[model samples]
Target: MKSLTLLITLLCFLTFSVFAHPPEGVWKKKLVWKEDWVQIWKTVKKEAWETKWKKVQVPVWKEIQIPVWKEEKVPDWKIVKKPLIEEREVPAWKEDKVQVWKKITKPVWKLIDVPVWKEIQVPVWKDIQVPVWKEIQVPIWKEIQVPYWKEIQVPYWKEIKVPVWKEIQVPIWKDIQVPVWKEVEVPDWKKIWVPEWVKMGIPGEKYLGKDHEGWEYTSHDLWRKKLIWKPVWKKIWRKEKKQEWKTEKKQEWVTKKVEEWKTEKKQEWRTEKKQEWRTEKKQEWITKKVQEWKTEKKQEWKTEKKQEWKQEKKLEWKDEWIQVWKPIKKQIWIKEKREKWVEEKQQIWRIEKKKVWATDKKLIWKDEWKSYQAPIWKEVKVPAWKKVWKPIWEKVWVPNSHGWD
Candidate 1:
């Protein structure tokens, strides 16, 4: 009954009004006996018998201890009573991982002073210099001052230099004829270019042919008048040297052809051979070749025999006048020796004569180029204006490939 009383009193105290503040001088405790059970019923405005009906419609949720009594049969009643003790337990200790105050981080910014250049767009009134060139034509002549002939042939890339003037032109884009830097151009006609004679390739000096005609062609030497010559007698005359006049006709055995070559036995040539053996080797060789040649005796003497070859031949002609000729060595490479008799001064020829350079070649620009004021450009208020500054540029033509005005 004592335990039952403690349980009911605790339940009655818990059921009391929680909104009431404890009065002064009154004990306030969480656990109380059934002494406050009347207060709980009064606050609800219901008698103890009606308490059940009062709370019937109101939802009440609380821990209530209803003592359930049951008698148990024991083998030995009250043999020994166990000591009354409160049970104690160890609780698990856990640390909370949730962050209380997290620090927020952001990128740091720095104020930087940057340099800027502003480009202003404006027309520049520069005295632009331009050159106006006139055409200069160079003649492609065979010789220095002569027109090319039918037989003369010129090759490519033959060049000649002629004096030309420098022209300075003013763009005249602006109203004023202010002169800029002098710019010149060498017009195609005005420029002296490859000449026909120059393209003739060393004027028979440098040639692929081994020799020119029967005469020798020598390499050009500035120091000496005469140079060495290799006879392309081998190259140009390779066919002539190795030529065989072969007539591919139907060949037949002919006793007549062989018998025709057989000459009558002449005692005049073979019988007196012992005396003719005294002939000089050079004369013998010349005589042998001359005898082999098939021609009229008179024609052979006049054609094969020249004044230079006279020394090697015998004076066999029965002529009316006895003509004598000069030495043969002096007559080489000469058309004739009669020119030697002419005045020595008259024989000398001047190649380049009466050639002069001309003036007024290129255009000339006016003199405002020295100190000309350029167009004014201004920019304000725009942040981008401070970023760009460009210079003014002008162009003009140059003379020829190598020279300029």
Candidate 2:
């Protein structure tokens, strides 16, 4: 069993070491670089410029034959007229005799029957009654006493305690100590060189020694003096007083007087007058005038005039003329110039270049071979896993009353 376990452990260790790092002891070929001089052919382009001339058409102004206008006036005839005397027949007015009707008016007297009326005075009687009023007396009203409730406030005296403070002096005694200085003669201490062996043999409580060669210093001694202090304090006291106040409330019953009145109806005697009317028949005279008309014969004379017309011969002068339009010829002359665009040959010079591309190889640098280290890769073999049936025994904790342990 120990031998088998050792073989399995050794195999696992070898496998882990082989896969964790790259393999060594492998040879590889590398390229070496070198420099040399060489020649090559390359293409190049060239350009050449040339001058040429071209013909173009241009516009110019020139003198040419054109139609000209001239202004000229011709003679024109017009008709004229003069005044001449002539005779014509026209209507005129003349005095003539004619017979006409005339009307004349004359006054005439006539008689007719007319009615007239006269007015007279009349009297009428009627009965009337009148009413009379008199003065009267009225009674006055009196008041009585009534009972009601009213509220009023009652006051009382009260006593309360209040705090009051009074100032007073209190004596406090305290003992205080004050520092007092005094001069004394003392020996001053100073450091001196001592060997380690000598310092070790000396006691810790013993000092080195006093300087005896006039090197002593003067010092003072400390002393305390007794003192007493007294402080002042004040005390507070409480006191009470009595006070009186007046308060009102609505809780009282009182009586008051109110006035009330009533009205009574009674009959009284009065005087009044009444008026009465009656109708009566009686004769009365009234004056009235009436209008009447009658027919009568009358004569009136009037004169009338009429309009008359007659024909008479007379002489009148009139002026006449005729209007005629005649055609007249005129000529107008003007000076002008003309211009046109003509096709003419013109020489224009320009510069042109021809490009020729040629390939020429150039040798700028030589090729070089360099040597460098190259990495070499190798295939590694891994062990394949196979299924093996075996029993696995594991220790697991079974839960009990206590926690897992």
Candidate 3:
């Protein structure tokens, strides 16, 4: 009984509880027991007996143990225990492949132009002064006196004295110029004589007798021639000369010069050579400046990549259950042996820790130094020639004056 109880206690202790699979990469422990007897119980309640006069009821349950047995033959038993070791070739997990990239740089070269300046010496010409002498002609004047003659007329008058004669009348009385004489008449008696002889008578007797008549004597008157004288008056005429006054007129001449003298002016000139200069324009070439631009590409390296790794695993396990009954108090258990099976699994992963750096194709730039040659020019000063003129003065003589002489 004690052995049976010991066996039952062992079987109860070996009862197993199922559990989920453990996490990866962790260690786990499991329990196992080998035994044959099983101990179990059932619970029942006791009821009270009833009679016609009274009935009784109970509410409590009680535990009870019952033993069962089967008739079978006892078999021989042996302990055979072995550890499960599985050998599986886990193909290496596929490793990840990574591509690397990088950048690179390079250098280039070119040519260009540059500017430069230089100076040169030049020459020039200068002018100077000079003096000269010359002669010229001029005008002069003088004064002088002159003489002339002329004629004129004169007038006069004269008077003279002379004698003149004329006749006049005169009256006069004369006394004793005419005498009145009477002559006596003693007549002719004596002259005439009668003859006496014839008469004889007495003279006396004739006288006395006128008284006596007789032949008487008578005296007779006689006429005879005689002379007479008388006085008379007379008128006379005579011629004489007379004096008178009268006037007279006459003409004369005058003279003078023709013109007068005055002063005058005149001018003179000379010739000479002179110096002069002139300028001209010229053309030449000079240097100039220009701008330029250039462009290029360069490359450099700058990238890194990592290698990949993964783990592989395999599992092997065995399971068995058995039961048996005998007519005696002894129990029995059995185990069977069979072929082992192994499972296969594969995984792929990359190891992120390992890395390597590599250069990629890219553009790179660099500057290069070089030299170029070109033509050079310099300006130099040189002497030049031009046309010029020079001037001088001189004097000479000439005629400029003319007038009446």
Candidate 4:
């Protein structure tokens, strides 16, 4: 029986050695019973089944901002002067001399005797005497005595005294009492039911220390680029005006005054001085004495009467004119202005606003503030699931207890 136990023990030892963990061999010698060995075996098997999680490198990133600037170009301008021309009319001056003649007259006189007649009145005077009488009125005065007497009377008035009466009045009053009504307010009471609140527990007491405030590994994606700038220049062109001077020989008509001597058939006038006799009859007046008498109011007046006597006499008169020869000269002229419509060819410079087009290309780069996340290398821990062994009591069948059945 000892031999059988030894063999069975050797067999169990070899089986445990084959399945045991390499680090658990030192504890296997101290085990006594099969139950304890089985327990150790299960511990070794659970140690092999449980697995350890590994840590890997992951990328973490953050975002930031940056600022940049750029540049541009502009144009400059200026002004200049130019010349222009136009056509107009101008006047010229000249003078001319001429010859002229005029006519004149002269007078001659001669003395001769002439006979004439006139009518005159002669006055005659005579003395006359007359007597006249006049009458006038005269006044005479005499004295006499007379007497008269008058009498007058005056008036007067008298007044008497009188009396008058007036009336008076009086008033009386009495006291009175009045009653007034007032409103009164009354208070009313009522009963109502109200709900009361009781404190149950403090809010958020269970999760006081469970706040997420730690750093965690995250991934972000971003890109990188570069900004470059280049300078370029463009030429500006415009249409401008330039003045050029030119002269041309031209023929035109001018106005002038011309004097001309022309012979023409005309009548001439002359005067001759000769002796001529003229006869005329003249008259004279001779007055004779004539008397006229008028009687009025026994007085006599004598007057002389006037008479006209005419006498005729023939008288000789002569007028003479001297013969004279005179020379007369006249001048003639022509007044005219010569003109013609003419068209002239000229060159004109015109200033026009013109624009020239050109193309200019330059590389322009602007640095703008950019914000993004970039990836970085870091280590992070993650949770992994593994199978483990648990010790528990279970009922199973054994070979024998103390006696065989």
Indicate which candidate wins on TM-score. Answer: 4
Task: Identify the superior model by TM-score, candidate 2 or candidate 4.
Answer: 4
TM-score of decoy 1? 0.09
Off by over 4 Å in 4: 1-341, 345-349, 361-363, 366-375, 378-387, 391-393, 396-405
Q: Give the alpha carbon lDDT tens digit for every residue of 151-209 in model 3.
A: 32222121111223333332222333333233233312111213222222111111223
RMSD of each: 82.7, 62.7, 99.9, 49.6
Off by over 4 Å in 3: 1-329, 335-356, 360-366, 379-405
Task: Give the true-structure RMSD of model 1.
Answer: 82.7
Clash counts for all predictions: 18, 54, 25, 7
Against the hidden reference, what TM-scores do the models get? 0.09, 0.11, 0.11, 0.13
| Candidate 2, 103-168: lDDT as tens digits | 322223223233322223333333333333333332212232222333332232222223234344
lDDT of 4 by residue, 1-405 (tens): 423755776686667658874323222222111211221212111112223333344443422223333332222232322233434444433222344333322232324344333334444454554443333322212232222222322222212112223233322223333333232333434333344444332211122243233212222222234332222343434322333434432223344433322333322222333222222333223333333344334434443334444443322243334343332333444454444444433322233444432223444443322334444433233444433322333332222223332
lDDT for each residue of candidate 1 in 126-181, tens digit (9 for 90 to 100) = 34334444343333323233323233222323222233344443222123232223
**What TM-score should be assigned to candidate 2?**
0.11
Q: Which ten residues in a row have the lowest lDDT in candidate 2?
A: 197-206
